[model samples]
Target: MPTWLTPEGKALSCLEKIKVLNENLTEIRELCQEALEDAVLMGCDEPQVRQVLQELLDSLETPFENK
Candidate 1:
């Protein structure tokens, strides 16, 4: 079996990865919210700010896949 399929590895793999991803995404969301609030306070247009953030989010996707 592959290393990741071993008993200890399985025990420590998928859930751990998902938990870490969730934590990172949560932190990014909080930071983005704070930045967007600051941008609005400084008179940046809300829609434009959201568009830029959306593009940034899109860039993180894998190429050629419909995910």
Candidate 2:
């Protein structure tokens, strides 16, 4: 499990918040693994699929950004 961090880089101190974050990350990892497996089974290039997924994540915008 990774140490959940705040936007300012401090480790999260709340147990509940840390648990939620860890759970969410685990869920995302499982979903991504399934997607990658499906893509590979459909004859997609593994590296390309991974790269596309990385790009997709990189393109995400955080709605909580300070205005």
Give the best candidate by lDDT. 2
- Tell me the number of clashing residue pairs for each predicted model: 0, 0
In terms of TM-score, the best-performing candidate is: 2
lDDT of 1 at 57: 93
lDDT by residue for model 2 (1-67), tens: 9887787888989999989989999999999999999999999999999999999999999888643
Candidate 2 Cα misplacement greater than 4 A, ranges: none
Worst 10 residues of 1 by lDDT: 1-10
TM-scores for candidates 1 onward, in order: 0.65, 0.90
The TM-score between candidate 2 and the true structure equals: 0.90
Where is model 2 poorest over a 10-residue stretch in terms of lDDT?
58-67
What is candidate 1's lDDT per residue for 31-52, written digit by digit as tens?
A: 9999899999999999999999
